[model samples]
Target: MISPVIQEEATGCGIASVANIVGKTYPEMKAIANGLGIYADDTALWSDTQYVRTLLKNEGIATSDNEIPFTTWDNLPDTALLAIKHHQEDGKDFWHWVVFKRIDGNAMVIDSAAYLDSNTRTDFGEMTPKWFIKVSLLHESSFDA
Candidate 1:
């Protein structure tokens, strides 16, 4: 389980929230994600499935066939929930952290980084393979819990 303090910190401030916790800007976070082999582009075409898979693997998390099902949002696992909550609390949007775990039914969570700076809250939603891949590959790791 994620610490309550961390969770509160992440959910409290917007971009500045993560900046305070991780001591880095959104752009810097993108660079770190890119360095970890994760793509960090928001206006790209295809989803970065490989990049997201690589990041999960690097973090000791595993996925089947290097792909996360888009429909796994109905029942997300605890780990994924932790990840999403942490990222969301930290004000992450646009970018995303996708996770595939089987704890609470076979489901995935799409934690968007765009919400960090978005003026509206409708930008974030359920995990889709395409969106998951794109955001996962580009999501900043500096904010990872």
Candidate 2:
């Protein structure tokens, strides 16, 4: 089971989500991001999409980013980083990041902010999948391209 870490602050959700998936502590990932000039006090809480990929790669994780439609959820790997667009009740639209795990036909979302209940099995209620970054922990030789 993956341990969940709540985003320390409102803007750190992206970093926090990635850290939680990669099994790193919030402070540890935050420090690396801070050193790379990616994390700012509060104003710069959101990370540039590409930079998130680079950060994962620098830590030796292989990842591929792609924009996939919500209907194609079945095509997603067992575990992936999902970018979802949600329309808030107040009429504002926001993009949130979460780690997705599919098991036994049930999809689970591991959100750093606990926006989702841990190990939730329900499909996307209001959130729509926009894109995802697939992470591979195995060596390149293990899988064929």
Candidate 3:
């Protein structure tokens, strides 16, 4: 099982999520996020997807161009950034970020929530994902090569 990167701040799940996907430490990811003006204290991140997308882009990681409505775990891509614990507030959308990866027919979620005893969650029923951004790590040219 892949080790999870526990979020260092209450609102730093976004940073930790990025770190989890990119194999960076929480502090390391936080510094990079801060350098890009992406702060955890900003609640705007809860509703905005661009910040996380931008962070992934900076690391040359590609994600789906648009959000895809989540159906079932079996339908999810091999790797994706999922939006769970979704809710609407003041007419804006907010959701927690979690990473999903399926390998060898085994699927699991890497949640950055600091309070969770186990960051690697496999109980799919407990999570309700609203949508997902497919994370494609390989560059297109890699397929050509």
Highest-lDDT candidate: 3
Candidate 3: segments with Cα more than 4 A from true spot: 141-145
Candidate 3 Cα RMSD after full superposition onto the native fold (Å): 2.9
lDDT of 2 by residue, 1-145 (tens): 5467677866777778768767788888888887777773543244346656666776777776454545566777777777775434345444667778876777777777645565343456755677677777747533222
Q: Over the full model, what C-alpha lDDT does candidate 2 score relative to the true structure?
A: 0.67
**Model 3 residue 124 lDDT score:** 97
Candidate with better lDDT, 2 vs 3:
3
Highest TM-score: which candidate? Answer: 3
Cα-based TM-score, every candidate: 0.34, 0.74, 0.93
Q: Which stretches of candidate 2 lie over 4 Å from their true place?
A: 40-47, 86-94, 103-106, 114-123, 141-145
Clashing pairs in 3: none
**TM-score of predicted structure 1:** 0.34
Clashes of each: 15, 0, 0
lDDT of 3 by residue, 1-145 (tens): 6989998888888888989999999999989999999999998776789999899989889878889999999999888899999999888888899999897989999999988889999999999999998877647432110
Error of 2 at 140 (Å): 3.1
lDDT of 3: 0.88
lDDT of 3 at 117: 86
On residues 78-125, what C-alpha lDDT tens digit does candidate 1 reach at each position? 333122331222343333333333333433222234333422122235
Candidates 1 and 3 compared: the better one by lDDT is 3
Deviation from native of the Cα of residue 113 in model 2, angstroms:
1.5
Better of 2 and 3 by TM-score: 3
